[model samples]
Target: MSYVLCLHRWVGRQALYERYGLEPGMQIRAICTAESAQSLPEDRLASISTLESLDDATAVIAEAQRLIELHGVPHRVVALNEGDLLNAAAIRERWGVPGDPCAWIERFRDKLTMLEVAARQAAIAILPAVSAEDPQAVQRLLAEHGYPLVLKPRCGTASRGVRILRQAQDLRLLQAPHAEPMMVQAFCAAPILHVDGWWDGERIVVLTASRYVNSCADFGPDSALGSIELDADEHERAIAEQVAALLAVFAGQREIVFHLELFDDGQTLRFLEIGARVGGAEIPFLWREVRDIDLVGIAWELQTEACSRQRDHARTRSRDGRPLHGERGAWVIGRRESPLRTELGTLYWAQEALPAGVPSGVYEGARTRLRLRSFDRPALVRDVERIFEHLAQTWSASA
Candidate 1:
């Protein structure tokens, strides 16, 4: 039996295990906080390990090794949750096991360093960003570059603690004592389009792209409504290729899996950021549907495969894997166009969690309310329009 060491005990672990056929009998180890560990599924509880100090790579890899030795070396050691990219690199280093290099993951995870490297490479146009810890330095840059800039945490995810600084006066609120260096970049009025794919070395095996309807909505801990549009063009592909090539340079000797977000400022493609792991929601599912490739599975093979011949397993198998029976679409609902002050209305659908109906102010996950209308893009569009109007009316009445 094979085993994979996932970093966090979140929804991602469950989904990966199920998708890769590693759920039952196979050992699935999860590293999480004590509180989260307690709530882990009973069947996989034995393999669940709790930790307090997973803030770095060394401690995490040590714990993983202990588990691996006790359970015997599993086929591949991978992480789906926190400290994963760190653990992956550490596992390869400490145990001589296969995993992504720490540097690759670090460059992807660390915004400042990523920008520096990208700039050095002259790979893609980027917004001028500086870590928030250097307030004076960022202020200096702002002075030189002007305002209407963006400030974001160096190591934050999903747009947490991100804010737009329109002028020098706006800097007052950003002076939190505990704030680390925030990445400050010149805000570009670019249409945000995300380019995602599975990479082995520099090779792009499975690729897909999408444009975001609302980037600001998903910028924080709130549910945001978004839908996916397929069929991109060569213009999008050219920019994605540049990102991929640059990432390949950054990874050097190590192999890695990556998801890069870029922007089209009408005339040019600009650098956004790259996620070391699989991207959230639509991108991952989109690849599987359109390319017939299981990015999760390919990542597993990349970590476990030893020889060039075995590389075929790492390739996408869309021609043979499950076929898409219908056109699929997903929508994330949240406080948008209206305030969350009243009963926006209920999400009606046979398969929704809130089948009883949703009241307003129920802001949830990245995908709060998704209507997966298969083979019905037109109907889905109409339904989404109606819902948005209903929400606006609901908020209007209360206001």
Candidate 2:
């Protein structure tokens, strides 16, 4: 029997277990923090070993060793959470298991290392970035890139601790003590587009290109964040090529899931940082709903190289078991912000009042999915604006 050790903080459990549980002779054991343990489904709870906290590496390692004693050395150690990526890799190396080692995973976790590697690749342009601690280096970047710089953690997720510095006074944020290293970069004005897919050791499988309605940097409790899957076009094709080239630069690392974000100004594509796991938020669901692609399932397959051909075949099949071109899908998050509350509440009410097929509900929670089709790009953009207008009106009326 093959054993897989799954480490997580708060995400990817359902998808990971559902895929791995299907494999014959595969035993899945999980080590998760107390908070995540409460959220586990009944079936998942059966095989899980809880930890007081995920912060202590020593505690995590001890729990992993206990699982190994009970189930034998894990054939593979998997961590879908970005924060736990290094820990998972460390465990794999300690056990001499067949998976990415700490050094290999660090290239993806550390922003500086990731950009340094990408900078050497052809056809890739990276924004000038430097450690915030080096005042002279930051001033050099400020002089070169000009005002309106970005400050963020060297290794952060979900746009946490991200700040925009528009002037000299904002530079004070850099002087503040940070728990982890932080970086400063030239702020790009172009819209952010994320390419969600996988690399099969050679080629990038183009799943979908999503255009963010609002900057991730702007995402907050009061922000209404969303994305729409872009139609297959020249722009998407170009984005896919760039993603392929970026992955090729890191050719040493193969068979992994990548969530690559880039800045596209009609004429140029600038490389933004990427995450080595599945894209956060509603991306995985968007892919599944619109393209019938199971990103998490594919991620597991990539690690084990199990059922690659089968998954490839399945990708071509639609939800109804027929070939599909694509479908327009939108995933929106309603935050505590008045605009989102009003817009999303109105939309939810409308969906409930209307018939089943009109904006069918896919998933609901902190993030919600609605099925509505816009015939063309202009129409889609207009529709999104209309929702914002409704939000504004609702906010005004309430005020």
Candidate 3:
């Protein structure tokens, strides 16, 4: 029997994958960390192979090959995590499966490549950047831009391994990063905004943007992260327009879910980076609970349809795959942790008012988070702040 193979991470993803992927006559299997796999419903996964981490792509692909040899070929390969995208693409390429190609994935994964591609199609303002490995390029960037520039992984997610060199001595913090490629870019002192949506191969069918309360770069060993969705009164249209232009440039053969970040001053927006996966942390949760949108399920369904099309030439042999069920909203909210404090990705408390039925103990992404929605955007923002005040007090006392 044919099955869907998913390279998954994070907790609380069991329901999303099961609902869309495990229909009658099909199976859903996964390669996930043991901690993450515990959340998976025992009955939903046909078989699961636990590993030290999904980041080890070689072991992951080997385990998948073993699974397929023992069970059957996967009709669809699914990968929702940012790190898993290329590995999933690699699997598809190996099996002659219908999915994104690895080279195409690299264009999005590699910071320099992404910037070059986006530049060809649009006049997006971007910070001057260079590969960290190139000594002369690094020297040129330092000489030109001087202090307080940014150095980040060429292909990083969730703001991991990023450095802001405010002074010369700070360069010592970057000891080489265990062989990961890095990029140095001029830093912009502006608020960072994120855009999330479904990008059909042709156009943006659905979109939403959020402004970070504290920039992801501000996140340190002791930090809190949060975001509030932009109201219609905000630059929702302008942000969407900019995102549409870039998405048009990066369109692939299959539909993709995107998470885009950029520097947004009141008058202009500068390109940061984009990921072709559902946004992490409280993003998918807020989208579902507040907007009645199932971003995760939509991602799963998009890949499934593509797989079917490839298997049967999609019946009509055309139509790249239908668009996502578009969802739009002016009010929603998410917090990655308490404003009081954090202990470097350590597990923290979820207060008594934690959203009903949402898992409570030991979730990885957030200390506490809530989903708020209203047609009254102003009222919704106030209510969000009020809750933040209360949660801050509760968490501060605990801290």
Model 2 Cα displacement at 15 (Å)? Answer: 1.3
lDDT of 3 by residue, 288-361 (tens): 65555666776777777733322222212212222122232222222434443432111122333444434422
Tell me the tens digit of each residue's lDDT in model 1 across 1-399. Answer: 556666663432223443344434665677665644544555643477777645555667678878878876655566643236666666766666655667756788888887877776666777677766677877787887887878787766656677788876888756755445566777776777766555656565545555665684244333244655434346645665666667666665455556677777667777878776666644455445444455655555455453332235434252111222334444545543333333223223211343222221123233244434445555655555665565556656766
Against the true structure, candidate 1 has what lDDT?
A: 0.57
Residue 48's lDDT in candidate 1:
76
**Local accuracy of candidate 2 as per-residue lDDT tens digits, 1-399:** 666787766632336455443355665677886556644555633388887667667899999888888778877787776767888888888889887888888778788888898898767588989998899999999989898999999887677788999989999999888878999998999988887776666876555677888877776444556677687777777767767888887754577678888888877888888877888766765556546677777776666544675367545653322225555656555432333343332132122222222221112223323333443555556666666565556546766
The total number of steric clashes, by the backbone 3 Å criterion, in model 1 comes to 13
TM-score of every model versus the real structure: 0.73, 0.83, 0.82
lDDT accuracy of residue 118 in candidate 2: 89
User: How would the candidate models be sorted by TM-score, starting from the highest?
Assistant: 2, 3, 1
Candidate 3 off by > 4 Å: 21-24, 173-177, 252-254, 306-363, 383-399
lDDT for every model? 0.57, 0.68, 0.68
Compared with the true structure, the alpha-carbon lDDT of candidate 2 equals: 0.68
Against the correct fold, how does model 2 do in TM-score? 0.83
Question: Per-residue lDDT for 368 in model 2?
Answer: 26
Error of 1 at 184 (Å): 1.9
- What TM-score would you give candidate 1 relative to the actual structure? 0.73
